[model samples]
Target: MRRLALAAALALSLSPLTAGAASAQTARATASRGLTPAEVGTWITGLGGRVGPVQTENGLTFFTVTNAGLTWAVFFYGCEAGVCGEVQFSAVVPGAGATLDKVNAWNRDNRYLKAFHTAAETPTATVQYDVVVLSGEGVAQLADPLAVWLQLLPKFAGEMGYVAP
Candidate 1:
């Protein structure tokens, strides 16, 4: 009788219906939601990046981010109240050796980032990558793109012949 009871308990624990219910409960407990600036800032700090004070301009929010000795701005867009749906990582360097051709080459060779040269008297090379944060996406989803940005920024600077000052 003891062996039979143990077998019955094991069968119930391994049953598909019980497993499905447990999965549903776990999913509900860890579901993703809209992103906020605090969450993003904390995530950046967790990844060893320095996040600057939040600022607002033209009704949009942005802040400075520094990681791996490279500094950039992270702009939040499509914001409602304090939540944002998208972020753009941007950096600009003096256009000393940067050319339209070089910018074009970078764009062609890169997957997630785009580069452009400004036509100002003191020209500049700018690179930007945009990531969309959807309602159903989690921290891992957002962090992956930020990680890629952090990894690629220095490479992009070198490609543009940017000498840090």
Candidate 2:
């Protein structure tokens, strides 16, 4: 009887019915909500990046993400009352040895990630990804973009012959 009770409890814990209801509750609670600039800043800090104070211009919000010798400008999009659906992560390549050729090469080989030079003197490498902001997994989904940024930051720096400080 004890064994049967244990088995029943385990089954209930793993039941799809219970799991679906829990997820549904979570989705409802966060459905209208989206990612926020403050959350991104906190997340960047958690990733060992030095985050500067967040700033807003017009409807866009952004902050600085510094890791080792690399610094990035992270921006949020689709924000309404602090919520956002997407993020753009960018790092400016140092101007001393930067070239548009390298930027073009990166863009040619990469899919979602790219490198470009604006009218600004420094070349910039960037990655942007959309977040699922109206689902139970919305917040967790942010790891997707962050993971890409983490993976690319060092590699891109190396490609540019940058020595991390």
**Per-model TM values vs. the true structure:** 0.74, 0.68
lDDT per residue as tens, model 1, 73-147? 888887776777788889986756777778889998888988898867776789999988877776567777877
Error of 1 at 150 (Å): 1.6
Give me the runs in candidate 1 sitting further than 4 Å from their true place.
1-33
Which tens-of-lDDT digit does each residue in 49-122 have in candidate 2?
89999998886688988776778888877766677866778776664445667667767876666676543555
Q: In order, what lDDT does every prediction score?
A: 0.81, 0.70
TM-score of candidate 2 on Cα atoms, chains taken together:
0.68
Q: Give the top-scoring candidate (TM-score).
A: 1
After superposition, candidate 2 runs with Cα above 4 Å error: 1-30, 119-134
Deviation in Å, model 2, residue 143 alpha carbon: 1.7
Cα displacement (angstroms), candidate 1, residue 32, comes to: 9.8
